[model samples]
Structures are given as structure tokens and as C-alpha cells.
Target: MNPSSDDTMHTLLIRPKAGRLLFSLLCSLLFTLPAHAQEADTARVKELQGVEVVGRHVTGKLRHDSLGGMSLDLSFLDDMPRIAGNADPIRYTQLLPSVQTSSELDAGLYVQGCDNAHNGVSINGVQLYDIQHILGIFSVFNPSHYSRLQFAGSAFTASAANRLGGFIDMQRPDTLAGRVKGELSVGLISSQGTLRLPLGGKSELILSGRGAYINLLYGRWLKVEESAIRYSFCDANVTWLYRPDARNTLWLDFYGGNDRMDYQEDGENYDARLGWGNRMVSMNWEWKRRGLTLRQTAYMTRYGNRFSIERPDFRLRMPSGITDYGYRLSLRRGRWTAGTDWTLHSIRPQQPETEGERQTTTLSATRRHSTEGSLWADCRFAVARNMELLGGLRANVYTIRRSAFFSADPVLSLLWTSGYGQFRLTANVKHQYLFRTGLSAVNLPTDFWLPADERLRPQYAYGLSAEYRTDLIPGRLQLSAGLYYKRLCHQTEYIGTPFELIYGDYDYRKNLISGKGENYGLDLMIEKRTGRLTGWMSYSLGRALRRYPGRFSGTFPAGHERIHEFNAVATWKAGRRWSFGATLVWAGGTPFTPPSYFYLQNGNLLSQFGDYNSGRLSTYIRLDVSATCRIKVHGGRESGLNFSVYNANCRHNDLFWRLKFNNGQYYYAPLRPLPKKLPFLPSINYYIKF
Candidate 1:
């Protein structure tokens, strides 16, 4: 029995069911009679022409948003507490109740028990493949270049297609008209600068750049004998906006970034080097008239990495990457929106080459190509005096190696507002055409992207959620609580042993396995949005389970599952020149598979694991605090000095466990133990605006 065939049948059966359900619900709401009917008199209609209903926008605050998501501005993220002189977007999002990280040293986000690869990250309508820098410690997004970030844990809009887990969209700031402003900042690890300049009367340009000098600092002050390590990273972005008339606008954007690391061991005669980067360029045009808006975008993006190791007599090099080219067109009028997007993907898996003193060998795999296209439409309207309904549909098609797959998904959201409280219900279906395979135990740059083909089918998910939000103190305090459930199909994972690469087995396709997953969770938050003190407290309880067809028939904990999570954040303005902030995080242990026992086979010692993700790591806890002081400069300019401490508690949180085998005995050793040394780090930075 082929899994792909089963998946195709299942998709065909579910599409019509989901469509009928959404259509029926929408029809019922649309035809429902109002409590009070108005007379069909022309005089009364004319007299009521000036009357209008006023309420919050559909995409405003999380509590008010129909989709039950969160939105954060750049100002909020910039002032949040951070670690290692890094204040990137992903780090801040990890503090949210519905988001979780695999470990302290990993930057990948596991939203609502979904795999990190299942989530989608986009910037200014362009998708991003490489979102991390410095091996997942920081994100590639430069805070100075973006204006706002939005996240959805479950249900998503029709415009956000082809993702099953969650959605994260980063929007660029609007054109800064009639303004010439910029800022410069210097931190312990990197330096950054930004500038916004108006060009003539109808155009503007913005540029930002950042570079790290950690390698220079280490070499100059903290050099170690018999060993050397070097690492550096840099990123830059440019945005150009032009408005020829009041109703027409154009935009051109570019981004480039890279990270490199090199290590050497003199005693062992070993040298290793790694480098990865991304390049993207996009063009957009928009036209608006009356209440209608039309926009079109074209973009190209590439992400790739290279790794090499050199020993005394042999050397090896591995290279892999992916490239995407796409275009989108969208139109919006009042309460309705429609759009279409088409993208082409090129994937290259890692190919390794080895060179020895006596022989040279090379192993390679064929590159894969695929195409994806989607069309979506949605609208929002009032179903009753105090209720609004939003419904959308998307049709997606993917073609790889001459094989085509189609999926039709439906999304629905309803919100009821009464006084200062709101209730929301949402249901959505999503599908994905690409999957990633690599080592799950560690975060590495060698992961490869693979497209769905004849043997493998696309992944799909069904999500449902209900939420209630109320203002506890009118304009000052807000509270929200929600529950969500998600079911996933046709998920893929690598099932081969981790040592395959050592034996020159570079073909990962053979080890692929298909499975299913289910996740359910509760999210709660209390937030203060005004006054001198503003922050939020969030908590989440969740469970995630997975099962394979034959080999892991019984459900097991997913790799990213956590039973409990809690976060507290606060910022206070002490005086005109001083501000302080703090953040605390506690989470239940992450699940992992440990070796249940070991045996000798054919005079060789081997290890066997229990059920997948059967063991749990130690719980994780961290505290971070920050303070900022403002200084008045000449010409009324201002500068700020920030000081921060990460891991204030000095706890030895274990990142992972490594099994050691010697003399028919096995022992477990902890990696990245924090308590043995002064892992607590303090950093200071200075920023000036002109």
C-alpha cells in the first residue's frame, strides 16, 4: 500500500467536506434575520445615510483580531530584555505563550507542537528560508529595518497559504515622507547603522547594515593556546519607495547576509570551516482608488551553505542550497480580498567529496525542481449587530518531477463583541508541498529541503480554536484565554541512524518515513498596554503526539512537546531618563529518545533506543534583566546606554545528552552544561539618533 495514494484519496474526501461545512456556516450567518427589522421606506433610508457603525479593526490587537493572533511593533521588541547582545525577532517571539524552543541553544520555533520547518516566515511579502544567524542564537532580521511582526498559532488568512504549523509575517515600515532621520548603535558583539532619506517630493530611501566583530575581540583579548576559533557575520538591507501620483506607488527592496565560522585543533591536526548566507531582491507596485486597492510583487531569494573539514591525510567538503522565484498579485476592496501567487523552487541536497593521499572520491545526488501556485479569496461582513464573520478559501497546486498534487482548503473566523469583551471562533485547513530532513538531535546548517513527488505526498493540517477576551480595567488591563486543537497528515521524518554520513551514505531519500501528528493546547495571557508600566504575563499547557504506520504504531511525544510553559515580562519607567525591564521564563522538559540498552552483535557493540521521544530532559528556566539611560546631547539630540544580564540565576541547563560506550559499558554525558562555568553574560550598548 503506497502512502501517497492513501493521502491523495484522503485529501479528495476531505476537501468537499471542509468546503461544505464552511459554506453552510457562512450561509446560515448571512441569512440570519436581525433582532430589529428596518422599514423599507426611502425617506428613512435617506435619513439614516449619515449613520455608521464604529468599532475596532479586524486586524488590530490580538484580543480583538478575528484570527486570534499576536502583533508586536518594533519599539516593543527593541526595548525587551535579551541575551548575548542579541535582540532579534525570533528571540522575542519565543517568549510568547504559544511558542516554544527545542532547547536553550536552539533558535528554531515550535509553534503549537508543530515542527520548526512546518512554520512559515515572510518579510515584506517575500518568504525567507534562512532565518537564523550565529548557529541559531540570533535571527537574521535587523530590528532597524522592520516596523511590525505578526504571529498566528492556529487559524490563518487565505493570503498565508502553504503552511501547516503557524505564520509569522514581518512588515517593512511605510515610506518616511519628508523626513531625514537615522540612528547608529554599537554593542558588545556587533555594530549597526540605519538611515532614511527623502528623495525629491515623492520618493524616499532607507538603508540599514550590521556587522559582528566577535572574532576580532577574541583574538585580541582572550586567545587560547594550541587551539583557535574565528567567527563573524554581517547583514544589510535597502528599500526604495517612489510615489508618482496620489494613487500609484512603487517599491524596490534588497537584502543580503552571511555567517562564517572556522575552527582548528593543533594537537589533533584538524581544521573545520562552515559558511552560510542568503540573498533576496523584490519589486512591488500598488494602485488605489476609492475603496479598492491593487498590489503586485515579484521577488527572488536564495539560501545555501558550505562545510569543509581537513585532517592530516584526508579532507571532505559538503555543499547544499535552495533557490526560489515567485510573483504575487492581490486586490482588496472594503471588506473583500483576493490574491494569487506562483513560485518555482530549486533544491540541492548536500553532496560530499573526499580527497585522500592515495585516492579521491566524490558522491553526488540529482537536484530537484518544483512549482507551486495558489489562488485565494476572503471577505468580512457583519452577521449581526454585535457579530462579524470572516470566511476564505484557497486552492493550491504543486508539481514536482511531472507529478501534480492539488488541495482545496477553507478558513472561517467569527467574532462577537459586547461592551468590553469579545469572543472568537476559528477553523482552518492548510497544506504544504516541501519538507526538510536532517539530524533532529542538534541544530545544524546541513539540513536539506525536499519537494513532494510521486512517492511522497504533501502535508496537510486541520486547526480549530475558540477564544475569549475582556478588558479587566477598561483601557489599562486586558486578559485573553484560548484553546486550540490541530491534526496533521503526511508528515515526513528521517529514520536512518545518525552515523550514515560517516559511512558515505549521502542519499537521505531512502531513509524517509511518513507519519501523522496531533496537538492540543490552552493559551492564556494578561497584558497591560498603557501607562509607565507596560508588559504581559503568559502561560500555556500543551501535549503533542506522533505515530508512524508500522514501526512506531503507538503514539509518542513529539520532539518539541512540552507539558507546561510560563513567561513574565515587565518594563517600568523610573524617571525621565531611566527605564528598566525584566523577563522570566520556565518550561517543562523537552522529550528525547534515550538508549534503553546495548548489546554486542557479531563482535560489535551496538545501541538501541526505546520508543521515540520516550525520555525527558531537565526542565528549563532563565531570567533576564535590562536597564536603559537616556542622555541629552548637543543640538537637542539624544543618546541611550543600555545594560543587560542574561541567565542571572546561573543555572546549569542541559542542552542535550550524549551517550558514551567503552568496554561494553555505556554512560551518559551532558552537553552544554551551564553551571560549571560563568555562563551568565552581561552586555552593554550605546545608541544615538539624529
Candidate 2:
């Protein structure tokens, strides 16, 4: 039989090995179909033939409109090497293709070249503003508290349209356990515990807590000759699930975390204290009847921080934060899902309070209030026998003071399944009403949140992507590849330094310049899904460029852009009692603007900056490995000991640069690297499960 045009096109697009697999699958399908337009006669059949395969497992879940997304089970984190003896969800996303962070220790996610504020992060369907603890070392989401994590790439559903970049969702287990279960872990730097208790036959409660003791165990370890620092953090999470009946369910979630840091510099006559915290609470209810389901939710969250600096002659304190109250309602029936969501925001930009030898003064930005709402609908349907279409529409409204803005966003995805594998093409348009601005070079808690207004308008993005996936070796190996492009509008870059931001006029809008950006990339990965050895290797090639009419005449590279990235991760189950994991990550350096010239005039100095993001840091490379051994307990329970080395090679990678004057000329040099003395970080943890 001759193949159709669609089949021919698909074959051409796929690789040679995948083409052959598709041919085989097509042949099997054709032969298994009924010869005539009639059902087979079951009574006359003599015997049935079948094939059974063992020792094979499905590794990842397939989600609709997930052309370049990932749906990972909680067990996936267990198989990977930990960072600082902790399994962090935000850090895991950095290992995937087409995703990047500010640096090794930064937790902010920059997806498809978008800023951290553009990405939406949520737990139990409620959006969260500050999602990290201990600065950027660890995220607030404890792996033990979450059952699954989902990352949506360029293509996202209508309900998640507000984010211009991507979406990160953490979900707890929906099922109620019949018996009591718990896990406890103690590590070199921190300790955590999770416990699940059944209230009755239909209700259950899960409690999790984590805290850091680095300050207690190794005080001033991250210190230099003239400076010393101390930092600590703690967080708690509680989730309650109630399944009163087969068709009804209710959930209550609460999370709170805080971070504190103290620093002193004797040579510079500087001393500072920084503190931040996050608190959130949410309630959800769900009901199902026949083939329809309805859900409602309400949530409230707040994040705030204070930074105080003291010198011999001056004292200054800056405070900033944001608070949100939100509500959502959704209904689903068969292939259709619709939802409405609204949120009210209260924002306080960074403002400084100063006390001099003479008097005390306070400088503050205008406190602002805003509201955002969205109506969305998503549907999936079959277009042909082997093709499906998933589409969604979102209408958003934003109100700030007396002004209002509206936008319509859309998402579309096409999926094709055959004997060989699957192919998906997706596109989406998104908008973000909130923006994040940071004073530090990297992602830090000092960053402040602001809402869109007349001067700083909302951000918009348009994205398109195509992906292909197929099994290369039955149940053992798989291949995935994708191409994506995104166009961004109304991107803002703050041109002020930390001092200017803190001491200058409170009208912060004067320091921001709006611009446009474009990002395109290619992602490829190959993995072995089963057997004694299971792992994956991935590579990404991408470019991110920005243009501002007044600030710069030419296009320049974005600060977060990384042109090349490669990662290799593997896990070996040496035996039932022992397991080993290793990972390697290498990427291009970050971009920075160097000083062009400096002049001294009348006992003062002035400098001119060079091209935007023209200088590059040294290449970044790191290797991590871990080993774990399991032991049996008295009552059939299990315990494990894990030893991990974050940067085994101790390669000191440059975090940023500093300008220096040499021979009367100015030049830029690599500043102090992170973990100044020892880049090699090792830790051990003991865990038990019952």
C-alpha cells in the first residue's frame, strides 16, 4: 500500500531510525484492522495471541499542550544528585534543556529568555510571590512535601496565561492514605521531616518542616580576612486533604518561611543585616457529578524584607514587599475546561530611611494598589484518526488606580500519534501584569515587585515551538528534539545601581527603560528509560537579544543569555541496596557591560559605560556525584545514608567582574568567586521512611 502525503511529510521530518519504526507500526496497524466494514466474529475465533513484556516502566507522564514541558514524578528527584544535601524543585528545572538561571547558586528561572518575574510559580494552584528561602540556596518547596512537579515551556494553558515566560506547578498527592507514614532526614547543613496522619477513613493531613543550621555548625565559614557573614532559614508546610465522598473533595494548604543574614566588614567600616519571609494560605473544594467537575479556591500570600546598613557616620534601612489575595473557580466536562481567576495586589517598592549625625529622614515611593482578573477556556479534540488539537483562549483585565488595561491571549497545540511515537506543534500568546526588579547582579531576596501602570506598561510575549519524540530501543532508549522562538514586548531594564535605587528620588519609574526582545533556541535530548542504568543527555543552543530605542542604538545580548549549554545525568542501581548518581553541567558565561572610560575632575571621578552586555565571564563547568545505601529496620521499615559532592572538582567559576585602575587605565577583572576558598562542597544526609 502507498503512504499518504501526511505520512510522507512526517517521515521526512523524523530521523532515519524513527522513520523505520513508524513504518513497522503502520504495517502492524494496517494488518490488524478489519478487512471489511464489519466486526470480527468472536464465536469462530479458535485462539488469541498476545505478547507480554516485563521489567519495563513508563518514565514520564504525557500532558496535553505540553510540546516542550515536563511532568515529573516525585521519585525522579530521588534518583538525582542533591545540591547542598537538599533536593530543590527550582534547581531541577535548571538542568533541563532551554532553561537557565543567573548562576550556580541562584534559584530564579529564566525560561525562553524571559525575566524571573515573567514566570509563574504556584503550589496547589495558588500563585506565590516569594518562592525561595535562604536567599537563593534553596527554594521554599521541600521535595518531601510535594508529590509531583510540572514545568510548562513556551506553550501553556489558558488558565496560566498571565506569565510571559513559563509556569512551574507543584502539587501534593490527591489520594488519602489508609495508614500513617512519615519521612525524616538530617544533613550536614540542614534537617527536614514530613509526616502523614489519617484523621479518619476519608481525610488525611501531611505536615513538613525544614530548617538550616549552617550558622550553628559552621559560623563565619563563608567569610574573608576582613569580613564575616552568618545566615539561617526555616520553613514549614501543611496540607490537609478531605475526601468526604467519591464525588467531593476539599484541601487546605499553609506555608511559611523566613531568612536572616548578618554581615560585617571591618576594613570598609560596613555592617548590615538582611531579613525576608513568605507566608501563604489557601483553601480548595472540588465536586464531581456524572462526567462534569467543578472546583473553587481562595488564597492569600505576603512577602516582605528589610535591609539595614550601618557605618561610622551614616545609618540606612530599606524595606519592600508585596501582598496578594486571590480567588478562582473552574469547571471541567469531558474535553472542555473553563476557569475564572482574580487577584488584588498591594505593592511597596524599596524605600530608604536614613539617619545622619544631625537628624533622621525617611524617603518612600508611592504605595500602590492593583487588581488583575482573567477568564479562560481550554478544549482538546481529535482532528483526525491520528491527530489531535488542543486550544485555549484567555481574556485578561488589569486595574491600577483609575486606569485599566485589557488583553486577549491564545494558546494552540497540535499532536500526532502513530506506531513510531508522537509529534507536537504549539504556539501561545501571553501577558504579565507584575514585574520584578532586583538590586543585585544575581537573583536575591532584595528584589522588589511592582505592578504595571501608565509609565511601565504590561509585558507581552508570543511564542511558537515544535517537538518530536520517539523510542529508539523499545523500552530502553528515547529521543526528543524541539525548536522554539519567542518575541517579547515592553521589557524593562533598570539602569540604576543599588545606591541610586536606595538614595535617589522615590519616583523609580525614571530609572526604568522599556525595550523589546527576541529569543530562539533548539533543544535536543536522548535518554535510556529502563534497565540497570537509566539517564539522559541534553544540549541547548540559543540566543537572546534586546533593543531599546533611547538607551542603545543597536541590539545587545540580554544579561541572562547563554548561547550553549550541555548536561549529562545518569543513575546506576548497582544493587538492591546501593545506588549511584552523577551529573555534569557546562554552559557559556554570562554577559556584562564594562566601563569604557573614566576621568577625574576637581576631586571627583566619572566613568562612561561601554556597549551593553558586551563582556563575557569565564566558561562555567561543574560535576556532581552521589551515592546512597539502604538498610532494613526492625519493623520492615527502611533507612538510607546519602553522600554527595556538589562541586567535586573545586573549579572556581567567576560570578561577576570588577573594574580596576592599573597604570592609569581602567580594566575589568573577575571578582571573587562563589565559595571563595573551597568551591568543592560536600555533604551527608541520613533519612528514614516508615
Candidate 3:
């Protein structure tokens, strides 16, 4: 078949077929019923009582823990205000004081001065590389499938290694041992469904899926031309749990998601297409006794993206992907825990295929295969009646590009409980061997991954933190304050622009540079945990500086650094059926590079940049509001309707600025700045439960 025909087949036939198969499988699992339905229902009541007890214990742990992490329940997210009515975990986490991004349009997370690549995100113990669906607009995680979400700023647990900045972990719900239950939801951007079924006495299944229909709505109702633009995404999840006895349990999990975007310009004779997705499978087993507990897990994960461009005379295709196979084992006795993890990584950074009448060739810049392993041990002990101590150690080994690298990390923490309050001190060291680079300012699918080699060494960091927390009114109000400092080495940064790489050279390594960074900050938060009116207020003051000896000797602010940040969130329960929420945010301007001057060279205008990150964008401010109403449905069921308004005050927060040059002159007129931003948007959603 011809090239155009082949492309059409893949887009129209293959994708739809795969999507149908996934949807069918999920539906079958969700609707399946047990042979002895009446018998199962009789036992479900007793099982539900036990589940409630376990839930209470988990909630208490979150409320009283001194680890300095944020814990959120899925129910809380349903009532929180969001953009476009999309309930995303990452977006909710970004509202915290310790996290910052370049702008509202950027999905990349900058945690405690560390870049997004330095942080790790996991779902059910499996790592994820690409987490966004439409560039920076929405996240791939389905809120309907998650039970709890947690985030740690600096000092993470030993189980989460190979990262320098921080980690985010999401947990799926356990087996629902009660009667069958399901929920269906419809919104402006997407639709989702969830079901939980009890198979028998010891087995249970849960299934969920979400898909976007924006393209269909636009084409049919809005009368949009089909050939102009197109975009869509879908994701599905399945989990099964079996508990044969009181001491042993087993679980199986599967997840798959995909996204695609296509754009065409008739006047310019240009076409561009981008596609990316992730798939994961895992199995876990656990056994517990009086003093000993053991757990094992095995999993496989894949992430990939493809970009293509075609014109009258030129054609190009670029593909990149990463695959991982991993296993983990852990044991716990009393206050001590030990674990080991082994993983094999297969990475294809960038492979370009060019076809034309004059030249046809396929080339790659960096393709790598590697193995990574880690062993860790940790312990917690009570030193006295009021004092406690915790310590851990980890050893890591990485084999990359025919070479091996090894490192050791240590963590320590001290806690003291007094009559007035609690105090904590922590110290840790971390190391990483993997990195990602992107040409666009936003977190797009075009980002590529690379491993450490002779020229590019691994990255490491050292961090220290101290905090004090107190309760003002026992269960009504609380306050926490912390101070932290971190030093990072061998951090990677992209120095060349996207146009330079496309028009000049495709060698990405030659255009990359490494540097060192330092960050110091203070954080303060005041929270009201339980009441009719509940919420939190937080403020952060920080500075992040970087130095690259090879390129420049002077230090400059990091691209994502903000000098000051403040956030306030509140929710009010007006009555049994009415609830309202509001969020307000303000932050300092982000730093950028400004042009020094313009010059004429051979009838072409060229510009030079001044010191790195010397100019600043405008200050950012935004407010969001939401309201929810509960209604009674048939068969004793419940339903809800949610309405939200983003940018309620109509603030024109700048996404980015464009630089304009005057008529063919090198230095004759002032440069004009054009701003692009998102305006006020309103959205609504409805959900029914049975």
C-alpha cells in the first residue's frame, strides 16, 4: 500500500478496533454476576462492617502522622474546584505551596526547585513516564478509580528510590465485599463509568473506564470542519482481588490509555500528527503472621510517542519509547523493614525516518538498554517516652551503555512530642540515572528520555529539613512551619531551541548542558480540619539558583523559580444538600531570557540573548469557584450535579509572550510584546450512583 493509504488505515481501522476490544473486556467484567447471588448478599453485610474499621484506621494514620506529607481522599476531590470540570490528581497537588509550574498552561511540576524529570510518579507500584493527555490541559489519571493520593516533598521512603526531588503515589480501592454497586458520570469534556462486583466468597472485581468525546461534539453540533483539527483520548483500568484465607491474599491489575492529535493547514500544505500512550500490567501477593509480613510484586510497563509531518516535498516521522520489566520483594518484622527491587529498561530516545524523491534514510541518535537494582533497609525505634528515631539506607547499581555505576544513600529523622506541640528533623541523600528532555515549554508528548553515560554522569542531591507543628484548638485548627535546604549536582538542561534542532542539526546531545543548583526555603501552613467551614492557607518563600561552568560562570535564577507564592482554599457545607468551594492563588513572575540586541548578517536578521534568566514575566493571579447539589434518586440511590467557574474574576494571566521585530531594521524600533492566555470558562457535570 502507499504511504498515505497506510497512514489512513492505521488511524481509521487499527485504533478503533483496539479501543472496542478494551471497552468490551471492561464491560464484561463489570456486569458478570456470581452463581449464588443470594448467598453472597447475606455475607456482604458482615464484610462491609470490617471494611469500615479498616478505613477508619487509615484515616487516623493520615491525620496524626509526622512525616510531612499531604494525603487526599477521592471524595475530597469531587467537591474541589477545577478547570474545565476535570478532576485531576496532579492539578490538585499543584495547589500546594511546595509545588510550582511555569504557568497555567504548563503541566510540568517543579517541586522544591527540582524539575519534573527529577520527580517520580507511580500507580499501584508501577512507574509512569507520560501522564498528560492533551499537552498540558488534562491528566491521564481517572479520579473515579483512585482511593487515596499522597505526596512527599523531599525525604521519601526507601521503597521509592532513584529520584532526587520527590514522589507521588496513588492507591486503588481494595475488594468491595458488599453488594454490587456502580456509578455513571457525564461531563462537558469526558464521560466515565465505574463498577464493583463480588464474584464469590473470597474474590471480587472492579472495573472503570473514561473517554473524551470533544471531537464528536464539535463535528456534529458545532459544525466544525473535520479536516481542520482532531483530538481524542481513552483509558481503562481493571483489578481483581482474592483472599483464600486470613493470612494470604493475591491481586491482579491492568491499565491502558492512549491519546492522539492531528492538525492540517491547506494554505501552507502542511500536516502534523502526534500520538502517545502507556500500558501496564502487574501481579502482587502478600502474606502476614504474628510478627512477620512478606510481599512480592512483578510488573511490566510501556510508554511511547510518535510524531509525523508531511508537506509537498518533505516527509518525516520521529518515534520514541521506553519499556520496563521489574520485580520487587519485601519483608517486615516488628519495627524493621527490608526490600529489594530489580528492573530492566529498554529506551529508544529518538529515531527519525525521512522519505523524499531525493533522499530516504532512517537514523537514530541514542538507543540504550540498561539494568537497575536497589536494596534498602529501614527501622523505627522509640528512644524515650517522648522521643522517636527513624533511619534507613539504600544501595543502587545501574548498568548503562556497557558501563556500571554504584551509589549509597542514607536517611535519618528525629521526632519529639511535647505537651505544647511536635518537632521533627530530617536529612537525606538521593541519586538518579535517567533523564528526559523536551523542546516545548509545556509538557508535550515530544519529550525524549536518555540514560547516564561517560559524558553525562548521574544526578545527586543532599537535603535537610526541620519542622514544628501544633494544634490550636485540638481538632478545630492546626499550624505547621518548616525550613529546608537542598543542593543538587549534575542537573541537565536543554540549551538549544526547537527551530535550531529541526533546521540545523538533529544531534540533541551536542546541544545539551549540565549544571549545579541550590535551593533554600521556608513554608508555613494553617489548617482547619473539621467544621462546617474547612480549608487551609499556605505561604512559601524560596530561591533557586543554577550555575553552568562550561557555558557561563555566573549564577542565575532557574527557569521555574518563583520568589513568593501564596494559596488559600476553603469549602463550606451550607446544608445537607448544598456545598460550596473556592480557591485563590498568587505567585511571583517566572524568569526568562531576553534579547541583548539584533544584528544584520548577510541580509538576515539575527539576535543574541543576554544573561540567562535575566528578565521576568508578569505576576500571576487566579480564582476558581464551585458548587454541588445532592438529589435523591430511585431505589434509594444518590445523584449529584456540580457547577464550576474557572478564572472567575476574568484575570488575564499570561501564558507566554511573543517577541516582534520591526520592519527589516536591526535596531530602529522598540520590540512589541504579545500575550496569550486562557479566559473565563464555565463547566458542569452530573453523576448517578446505584
Name the candidate that leads on lDDT: 2
Cα-based lDDT for every prediction: 0.78, 0.79, 0.76
Residues 1-690, model 1: lDDT tens digits: 211110111111224555566566666556654624645552221121232222221111222354577777767755556566766778878877788755655768889888888888878878888577767878888887777888887656788858888778788777555768788889888888888889999998989999999976655432223257688899999999899998998999899999998878554577989899989999999999998999999999999988888888888787888899999999999999999999999988776677877456687656789999999999999999878899999999899877899989999999887775788898999999988777755556767677888888899999998888776754456788888899999888787764455444456777888989999999998887656788889999999888888877688888778889998888887887888888888889888788788766774557878778888888888888999888765664669888888888787677777665555555676666343546677888888887
How many pairs collide in each candidate, listed in order? 0, 0, 0
Ranking by TM-score: 2, 1, 3
Off by over 4 Å in 1: 1-64, 219-228, 264-269, 356-361, 597-606, 633-636, 660-667, 673-675
Winner on TM-score (1 vs 2): 2
Q: Write the per-residue lDDT of candidate 3 for residues 1-690, one digit (tens) a residue.
A: 111110111112234555566566566556554534656555422111111111111111123256667677766766777666676778767776678744665666788888888888888778888788766666777877778877888764566668888777778776555778787878887888888888888888989999888767653332112236677889998989899988998999888999888877444577899999999899999999998999999999999999988878778788998999999999999989999999999999876677766566668545688899999998989999778888889899999867899988898889887867888899999989888886754557788888888788989999998988876655456688888889999988888764443345466787679999998898888877666777788898989899999797699998788889988878888987888988888899878777888677776557788888888777878788999888765675789998988778777766544343334433433211111233566788898888
- Which residue pairs clash in candidate 3? none
What is candidate 2's TM-score against the reference?
A: 0.89
Better of 1 and 2 by lDDT: 2
Question: Candidate 2's residue-wise lDDT over 1-690, tens digit each?
Answer: 112112111111344565566667667667767655556663233222323223345343222233456766666666567777897778777777778745754778888777777888888878877677656766888888888888876645787748888788899997787799999989988999999999999999999999999877778576633368888889999999999899999999999988899889654577899999988899999999999999999999899989899988788888899999999999999999999999999999877787867456777555789999999999999999888899999999999999999999999989887776778888889888998886666777777888999889999988998888776765556788888899999998888765453345544577789999999999898877666787788999989899999888899988888899898878888987888888888999989888888776553346788888898988888888999888765575779888888878788877777654434454556764356567687888899988
Look at candidate 1 and give me any clashing residue pairs. Answer: none
Mark the regions of model 2 whose C-alpha exceeds 4 Å error after superposition.
1-55, 59-68, 224-226, 357-360, 364-366, 501-503, 597-606, 633-636, 659-668
lDDT of 1 at 183: 81
Q: Lowest-lDDT window of 10 residues in candidate 3?
A: 52-61
Stretches off by above 4 angstroms in model 3 are 1-64, 218-229, 264-269, 354-361, 364-366, 597-606, 633-636, 659-678
